[model samples]
Structures are given as C-alpha cells and as structure tokens.
Target: MNVSDIKWEYIFNIELAIENFGYVLSGIGYTLLISAVGFALGLIWGFILSLMRISQLTLLNKFAAIYISFMRGTPTLVLLFLLYFGFPFIGVYFDAVPAAILGFTLSSAAYIAEIIRSALNAINHGQWEAGMSLGLPRQKVLWRIIVPQALRIAVPPLSNVILDLVKSSSLAAMITVPDIFQNAKIVGGRENDYMTMYIMVALIYWGICSGYEVLQRKLEKQFGSY
Candidate 1:
C-alpha cells in the first residue's frame, strides 16, 4: 500500500502556498511584535518577581510564590481566554493584540521568575561577602557582583524562554489576533488547502526559532567569557 494504492489522491497545492505566501508572511511582523514586547515586559516583571521570591520579607516571598504557582499551574490558553473574553464580565475589556500581549507577558513571567530565582540563588554567597568586604554597599554589591554573575549563568535559560515565547505566540491565533498562525489559518480555510498553509506556518515558526537558538549560542559564548 503506497502512493499509487491510495484510492484518492493526497495533494499539497503548491499554487495555494505560493499565492498566499505574502499573506502568511505578513503576520510575521505581528508575531515578532508580540513576542518581543511581551518578553521585554515579562523579563522586567520577572526580575521583580525573582527579587520578591528571594526577599527576606515573608509577605513578599509568599505573594511571589503563590503568583508563580498559580500562573504555572494554569494553561496559557485559559489565561488568554480570561483576558480576552472573561474580563468583559468584570467591566474590563482589551483588544485582540493587547490581550494577547498581556497574556503572554503574564504567562512567560512565571517561568522566567523561576529561572531568574534559580540563577540568582546559584551565585556563591562568598561573592556577596567579598563585595561587602571590599567596602561596597549592599545595593552596590548586589547590582555589581551578584546580578552580573547570575545574569551570566542565566543567559542560556533566559534564551530558552525567548524561544518558547516566540513559538507560543502562535497561540494568539486562537483569539483572532491575526498573527502568523491566524493568517495561515485564514488562508487555509479560504483556499481549502489547510495542509499547505499549516506546513508553511510550521516552517516559518521553525525558521524564526532556529535563528533564536543561534543567537543563544553566541550569547552563551559572550557570557561564558567573563
């Protein structure tokens, strides 16, 4: 039972892929925009969460712990649904793009918070002592000595988060955000060529993520040097 043995022909319409090539590719901009902006905001929020997680104050630590646990336990899609759909019931409403951005930011920050916490915790306590012994203030010691080392250790995992965000940005399609996957889905439906459209979208996502992985390697080299 091979290709010839099949009763009906399985055709991948290259014409449809070629015709809608630009249509699908156009969504790349929105996809990148969402990922870049979300990741940037999430990183900042995550850093704050990381600090809170490691804070000596019990309230801050507990709050950060519960937040991270809740975000991690729930599905990202549910968060998106709550933001885009459920929020309207409470008198909150967000447009598609904003909702998608906020959803990713909130979800990614949870994972990033843990990554940052682990990295920060990995730094040697002696490094902190050494900085203080050199007459540095606690703030200065943390910023100059502790954070730099931790960031170096964190580059790889943080890079992984970025890649994850890029791929996960496809989820924006579910809410009619018209990102790459959404546009592809549109073309697939209109043309009745779902296979080609989906395959093209998958390749595009692969290409984008492959570039991030390459950048990750370069970042590892740069951070590893010092």
Candidate 2:
C-alpha cells in the first residue's frame, strides 16, 4: 500500500492515548530499574573483562576475548529467552525483571569491555614509564595513573551503552516484565489504538534518551577536567 493511500487520521486516537498515558508512564520504574542495575553491574564486570583482556596470562586474555566475542555476536533476545525460560530446564529460574537485567548486563558488558580496553590502550606508554620512574608498582600505575585518564575517554562510550541499555529494556516485554513498552502494548490492546500507543511510547523513550544525553554531557564536563 502506498503512504498516501493509508488513513492516518483513523490510525491514531489522540484523546484515548492521552487518557491512558499514565498507565504507560507507570511502567517507567521497571524500565529504569532494569537499565540502571544492569548498567552498574555491567560496568563492574566489564572493567574486569577489560583488565583480563589486557592481562599477560594467555588463559585470561583468550577467555576474555572469547567472552567478548560471544556476547557481542549474539542477539540479546536469545539471551533473555535463555535466562527466563531455558534456565528452568536446569532448575534455575528468574522472573522477568531479573532476567531482563541479567540479559542487558551480559549484552552491554561486551561493548563496555571493548570501550574500556581501547581507552586503556589509547593512553600513552609514557604514563607507564613515568609511573615506573616514580617507583610505583605496575598495578598502582594502572589504577592510580592510567585508569583516571582512561576514564575520561571511556565516559562518552559508557554513557552511550547506558542509553542503549535503557532503550533495549523494552525487549523485557517479551518476557512479560511490564516495562514502559509493555504497558503501552497493554493500553494499546485495551483501547485498540496501537499506533497512538506506540507513538507515545516512542516519544517517552526519546525523552528518556534525551535526559541521558544531558547526563552524558555533564559527565564529560566533569571528567574532562580530571
């Protein structure tokens, strides 16, 4: 069908959408929870993965490389299904929310690891030499001298990962997590106004991502001075 042939006016119910907006907005809590917890945990795990990637131990380095490769290669939806559904086969189970958080964490960590790894490598070898000249141990040089500088470079990409996690949290609906997109689906089904409901949900997501962009800027400013 051609775009001009479509009935745009009949496809959206602005009044119905506005009245049910609150129900959709109510799901933002779950959305933020999944995104924030997932990101926080992923950051910790990803930093470790980054360290492992850079380690001299071949076992740790190869393992980290394979992990990052696997996570980055697979679709997160498959991961969510494995966590929420497949785990029950082995007598391990997670309700939708925990499953979603786990999925996002596992998925985001690979990207975060790469971001951190590149940032670490990007730092000049001069910093390492300088730290050694000061009689600091290698670990101390990494943590005290290199990491702080690497963090500034890592901030932008890390912020992007958080924003992506937030947006991707919508997929939690597939596992019945009742996030914002899920709630929108509920309202849409109830009101039979799918287009309107989805449009509003998209706008809400845009608003959220915009807020994260602002936060990213603030983080950049803070880190830029460090």
Candidate 3:
C-alpha cells in the first residue's frame, strides 16, 4: 500500500458513512448526557461539601477535610476503576455509563468544593458583617449576596473544568459507553481509515473545547465588574 496514494472512500460507502454519522451523533449525545449529569451532580454535591468544610462543627469539618484531601490526592482513573470494578466486589454493580458519570461527578465535586471554599474565603469578612447589619439572616446573606459573587469568581475555573470533563468523557469508551472516540475507532477499524476517522474525532473535540473557551471568556468579562 502506497501511503501517499491510498485512495479512501467514506468507509463501507459514503451512504454508509452518512448513516453511521447518525450513530456517531448518538455517541456524542451520550457523551453530552454524561457531562451534564456529572456537572449538575457535582454542583450540588460540591456546594454541600463547601459548606461542610466551612462549618464550625468539628466532626463535620473534619469529615469534609478528609473527603476533600482523599479525592484531591487520588487520580480520577483510579477512582473510576474503584467505582466500576471494586464496588462490584461489595455487591454494588453500576452499569458502565453510570459508573463513568458517577466517577466523574465525584472528582468534579471535590474540585468544585475547594473552588467554592476558596471563593468564600476570599471575600472580606466585613461583607458578612455588613449583611448582618442589614438584618439579613446568615443563610439569606449567603444565598443572595455571597454565593452569587463567589459563583462569579468561580465561573472561569469551573467552566474550564467542565470543558475538561467533556474531553475526559472519551474515557467512557473504556467502559463501553460507545462515545465518539469509540465509534470512530470501530469505524476506522472496519474501513481501515484509522487516521482519517481519528482525525475527524479530534477535530470534533477541538471544536467543542473551543466553544467552551469562548463561553468562559464571555463569562469572565461579564463578571469582571462585580
């Protein structure tokens, strides 16, 4: 095979490739689903963990500290293996897609918790005092004023992480989620167009990540005045 003169048609056929494009889209759909679930779950879980870290109660604070430390210290790949394979030893068998989502969510929550905690700490203590002077309850003050500003500060980093999650979701192929890369691999193998198929997949990832970068910049600009 002359590498330079390799004539390639769209795999199976151009019509077949088009049909499989729909399958590839399905894979991307599942990828988006996993990211969405992980992001939302992480947001809620991380918010609670942030509060626990800042709590005055010794036990609550200590538990949160350990949780954050452990998660931060461990690799996400190891965490995913534990959730998918190790948990089954204890009679907890999560399906592959769910396992991937849960693993990503746990990792995301740990990072987001720290982000929230640091953002909260960054505000001047006088702000809390000012809120109290205005007769706002502590929770009300946090919800209305402190959290809003903290989220503004956190958005840039969080958006970067979310974009990372989207790319990281390629790992879902390991658990058989049929994600974009996996579909590309399958098609590339059948048609022996590995380079072309994977190149297309890479372009897809780059396009999505670029969109996220644009969104992140817009967010930072919008929040700069706050």
Candidate 4:
C-alpha cells in the first residue's frame, strides 16, 4: 500500500488517546500504592535478612543465604504467578493487590538484603571496635552506630531498588490489578488506539522514574556528607 493509503488513524488516534487520558491516569494511584507498600515491606524484611546473613550463628547465615539466593534466582513474573495463581493449591487465597504486593516485596527483599549486607561489610572494622571501646553493648553499637552508617552508605543502591519496584508494579496488570498498564490496555481496547495508549503509558512510567531519579541524586548528596 502507498504511504498515503495507510490507515494511520487506526494506529494512532490522538483524539481518542486524549479522551481516554483520565482512565490511564486513574491507575497511577494503584501503581503508587503497590510500589510504596511493597518497598516498605521489602525494606523491613530485607533488613531482617541482612541481620541474619551477618549474624554469628551458622544456621541463621545459611538460611538467609539460601532464601536470598532462591528469591534472586526466580524471575519476578514467575514469582507473581506463583503467588497469585499457585497459592490456591495450598488453600491460601489473596486478592490481586495483596498478591502483587507480596510478590514485589519478596522479590525486592532479596536484592535489598544484599545491598544492606554489602553496605554493612563496607564499614571499617575499627568502627565496630571503636563503638565497643566506648562501652557500648554489641547490640547497641549495631543498632545505633553501625547500622546508621551502613544505611547512609546504602541510600544510593536502595534508591535504585525502590525505582525498580515502582517499575515492576506494572506487572500487577497480569494479575488483573488495575494498575497503569492495565488501564492503558483497557483504554486502548475501547479506543482502538493501542499504539497511542501504550506510548502514553510509557511516558507516564518515564515521568515517575525521572522524578525518582531526581530524589535519588539529592539523597546521595545528603548522605555523602556523612
């Protein structure tokens, strides 16, 4: 077909895309909710795993290592399906949002654990000795002095993980969660403008990631001073 004969209108109807903008935007709330909750829960769980991985106990260290390895080895989508679809076999049930949150949290925790563990390892041994010399108990020193410094060191990497979680939130669409991607699909189907709607969705994700990048830089600067 000649270029002029191509049905460009079907591929990208800008007016239809514009009309459905609200539908796509509406999913942002669910996207943000999933990422925020997932990141927070992941951080908490990851910190616990980090502590276990670094502990003196052999069993704790081994368990943490295995758990982290398994989680990191699994693809995120596979994990999402396992939780959302596979759970029913074990008689556990989860709504789409909860299942997505659980999957993201589990997947993110593995990476976060490694990030925290590496940060902890980067601290000079003298810091721990100094804290001890100051008459602080081991637990006190860990919680107060060591962990604070490690977390400061971890800020940059953890920010990246948070951004990843935000992007991964889009995968919730597979489980029927009405996240941004799902909303875009719905709008595209209704408008028959898949290309336009998907491009708009991409821009929305890009905008969110770009905003986080700015915050990450500021955080790095603030933490670098410490």
Candidate 5:
C-alpha cells in the first residue's frame, strides 16, 4: 500500500469490521465503565480521605497521608498488575477489568483526596466562622456551604484529571482489555491499514476530550459565578 497507490476509495471492510466491532466496542465500553466506576469510587473515597486529612485526629490524618503517598508513588499499570496477579495469592482473584477499575480507582482516590483538600483549604476561614455564628452545625456548614464553593473552584483541575483518566485507559490494551487502541491494533493488523486505524482512534479520543472541555466550560460559566 504505497502512499500514492493506496486507494482512498478502498472500502472499509464493514462486514469484517462489524464482526470484530463488538470486541472493539466492548473494549470501549470497558474503558468507560472503568473510568466511571473508578472516578465515582474515587470521589467518595477521596472525600472521606480529604475529611480525614483535615480532621484533628492524628491517627486518621496519618492513615490518609500514607494512603495518598502509596498510591501516588506507584504507576497505575503497576498497581493494576499487582491487583490482578498478586491478589490471587491472598484469595482475591479479580479479573482484568475489575482489577483495572480497582487499581485506577485507588490511584484516582489518592489524587482526588489531595485535590479536595486543597479546595477545602482555599475556602476562607471567615466562611466557617460566619456559618458557626449563624448557629449552623459543623456538618451542615460543610455540606451546605463550604463543599459547594470548593467544588466550583476544583472543577478545572478535576476536569483535567478526568481527561487524564480517559487517556490512561489506553493502557488497558496492554492487558488485552480490548479498548480503542487495542481495537485499532487488531483492525490495522487485519487490513494492514495501521495509519488509518490509528488516526481514527486518535480522532475518537480527541472528540471525546473536546466534548469534555466544552462541558467543562459550560460548568465553569454556570457555577463559577459563586
């Protein structure tokens, strides 16, 4: 397939691609599922960790510090491999997808915790004092006032983290998880159209990330006024 000789009109093998498309689509579905579950879990875990970091209890703060340190120090792929391969010795036999989710979620939780802590710190001390003066409970003040403001300030970086998560999902292909890159590799091997397949995959990823940016901008505009 010389550059000039390669036919642009060369029809994409839709039938063959369709037959294999399910695997590809399944890979993408797995990618999205892992990201969604991982991020959601991270949010909850991170919130708790953030609270712990800010708590007056020395033991809880130490635990949060250690968890964030461990996860942040390790690469996500290494973490995934550890969970998938090492856990079986301890009787926790997670399949590839579950392992990926678990690892990513753990890693994400660490970063998210730090992000939330920073956001929490960014809130003014006056806000807390004012809330307390109004006779609002500590939990109520955090839930009803502080958290909302912190989240708005946190959205930009948080959105960036999500974008990284989406891209990081490509690593799942290494474990034969059938994500977009894996799909492109398989198709390119069959058709010998490596460039086209890769280009298409890049476009797809770009499309998703671009859409996220648009949504992020809308969110910033809508909520940033606070």
Candidate 6:
C-alpha cells in the first residue's frame, strides 16, 4: 500500500497495453456479438411483453405486469448466476456464451418492455382514433401508426439500455466466458500487471459506451426532426 510499492508505472505503461492489445481486442467480437444478439432478442420479446401489458385481456395484462416487476427488481448479476449455475437442477445446461446471452436478453427485455410501453402510452389517443377512422384494423393501426411513432420516442432510452448491457457484458468473465474483461484478467495474471491491463480494459469499455452515446445523440436529433 506504500506509494513506492504501488508501481505507478504500471498504470501508464501504454507499451504494455499495446503489447497485449490483440489479446484484449480479440474479445471485442464476442462482446459485440453477444450484445447484438441479446439486444435483438430482448427487443422482440419486450415488444410482445409491452403489448401484453397494454392488452384488453386482464390475464395478459396481469402476466406482463408481474414479469416486468420481477425482472426489474432482480439484479443482472443474480440473473447471470441463476442461468449459468442454477439450471442444472432442472437438467438444463448452457455453455458460458449461451448463458450470458440468455441472461442479458431476459433481463434487458423487462426494461425495454417498460420503455416501449411508456412511449406507446405517451402517444395521443387521437392517433389511434384517426387510424381507426381511416378504416384500418386495430392491429394495422397499431403496427403501421402507433408502433412507428412509439419507437422514435423509445430510441434514446433504448440506447441507454443497450449501452448498459454492453458494459454489463463484462460480467461474463465471472462465468469463464472469454470476454474483454476475462482476457484482461488473463493477461494481467500472466504479466503480474493487473493495474495496467485493467485500465486498458476500462478505456476500451469507455470508448464503446461513448460511441453509443454519440449514436444516441444523432438518433435523437433525427427523430426530433420528424
């Protein structure tokens, strides 16, 4: 803990980071692949959940409400652990990558559902009425008119959720997934330079998150112009 014993050089050893760059960069593909699949799956399932939440059927509405509540209340790490470790009791087994993707998708769906629902609710009822007056079926009106507008409103928040998922994907390391964090840990252990390697990992994550933020802003501007 002494200042001299801290190995301050390790923190700024850009050359060390560069040397291990390929090792860390190699994990980016897995990270991006998982995030994309997870977010896409979550979006599809979440849309259904949102529809259920807003349905006329009491049973559907109740089911969606309970699901959203439970998922939102649970932590992502616990969900990951449950999927990776707890499934064996039911005779189900998932490899690290599948478990991580499934865990992220399930957790993300709850939040995305709520986001879509709120955006849908915010649309003026007049739009729905107008579509109905145009001789459109309810489903047609929902899909053609309501959903398009709701999605525009939902994009910013959805971007935030996606960004969070990207960062949280780092937790895959805990399950022995060879993600960015896991690679960093391996390199750090081998070099005995934990501080520098982890800093590099943090910067990589920061860069990715910042890129998402930029995209979100551009999307917001485009959507706002409509």
Candidate No. with top lDDT = 2
What ranking of all candidate models by TM-score puts the best one first?
Answer: 2, 1, 6, 4, 5, 3
**Alpha-carbon shift of residue 148 in model 5 (angstroms):** 0.9
lDDT of model 5 at position 18: 50
The TM-scores, one per candidate, come to 0.96, 0.96, 0.86, 0.93, 0.86, 0.93
Backbone N/Cα/C clashes per model = 0, 0, 0, 0, 0, 0
Tens digits of per-residue lDDT, candidate 4, 1-226, equal 7999988877777788788888898999999999989999999999999999999999999999999999999999999899889999999999999999999999999999999999999999899999999999999998998898898889989999988888889999999999889999998887667898988888898999899889988888887786
The per-model lDDT (C-alpha) reads 0.91, 0.93, 0.84, 0.91, 0.83, 0.92
Ranking of all predicted structures according to lDDT, beginning with the best and ending with the worst: 2, 6, 4, 1, 3, 5
Report the lDDT tens digits of candidate 3 across residue range 1-226: 6876755553234554555666666688777888879988998999999999999999989998899899889988788888888999999899988999999899889899998999998888888999989999999989888887898889987997788889889888877788998998898788776666766777778887888789888888888866
**Native-vs-model 1 lDDT?**
0.91
lDDT of 1 by residue, 1-226 (tens): 6978854322456777788989899999989999999999999999999999999999999999999999999998999999999999999999999999999999889999999999999998999899999999999998989998898888888998899899999988898888889999888788777888888888899999999899889888888897
lDDT score of model 4? 0.91
lDDT of 4 at 128: 93
- Candidate RMSDs in Å, in order, are 1.5, 1.5, 3.5, 1.9, 3.5, 1.8
lDDT of 6 by residue, 1-226 (tens): 7888986786768889999999898999878877889999999999999999999999999999999999999998898889889988899999999999999999999999999999999999999999999999999999999998998999989998999999999988888899899999999999889998989999999998899899999988887887
Task: Give the residue spans of candidate 4 off by over 4 A.
Answer: 1-12
lDDT of 1 at 216: 89
Model 6, poorest ten-residue lDDT window? 4-13
Better of 3 and 6 by lDDT: 6
Q: Which stretches of candidate 2 lie over 4 Å from their true place?
A: 1-6
How well does candidate 5 match the true structure in TM-score terms? 0.86
